[model samples]
Target: MALQNEKNNRYLLRDWKPENPTFWENKGKHIARRNLWISVSCLLLAFCVWMLFSAVTVNLNKIGFNFTTDQLFL
Candidate 1:
């Protein structure tokens, strides 16, 4: 089981020595850019959801849903 798990995790970066220039040039740069773009995309998605909720809450009463102000904010 342990050997199987190790084989499964062979591609995982357990040591992560980005300070080594050769490793950085060969692999670290690609990994860093991938992680950065993933983070940026997730952040953008969260912002869009927040804006949609805010707009809906502000206009809920105008659309005939009688939620209290505190409930809307919540």
Candidate 2:
């Protein structure tokens, strides 16, 4: 069942056929590209956050954390 809820700006598509050229030309391409970029950006941001902690830990002594080299390695 295809339902369009204008008040909520929601469209429920019961069937999806991306192979249909008309649909892809009209809407699918834009949606797909937008989602792809969003996903890629989120992944990159997550990777940066994950790596930032390691960088901070490596410089903990410089920041006055009093961590020894051995402790830093651990």
Candidate 3:
């Protein structure tokens, strides 16, 4: 048996049987959905950060930075 860290409410699950329809209907679906949303949220956050940098770089000239190509690349 796996020992759970009760103080943190973290479980070391000994087994996972999400393939069982009863389990899937009751718990697996919720777990799966939560994981999917978490992944999507992370992807969106990453994309936003990437776009922010791209936008900043594109507007450097318009903002009158007077930076060289090598400087901007830095």
The candidate scoring highest on lDDT is 1
Q: Where is model 1 poorest over a 10-residue stretch in terms of lDDT?
A: 7-16
Query: Lowest summed lDDT over 10 consecutive residues: which window, candidate 3?
Result: 1-10
In model 3, the runs with Cα more than 4 Å from the true position are: 1-14
lDDT of each: 0.88, 0.80, 0.79
2 or 3, greater by TM-score:
3
Give the local distance difference test score of model 2: 0.80
- What TM-scores do the predictions have? 0.80, 0.61, 0.66
- Runs off by more than 4 Å, candidate 1: 1-6, 9-11
Alpha carbon deviation, residue 10, candidate 1 (Å): 6.2
lDDT of 3 by residue, 28-59 (tens): 78777888999999999999999999889978
Error of 3 at 47 (Å): 0.8
Tens digit per residue, CA lDDT, model 1, 1-74: 98788878846666677999999999888888888999999999999999999998899999899999899886
Candidate 2 TM-score, true structure as reference: 0.61
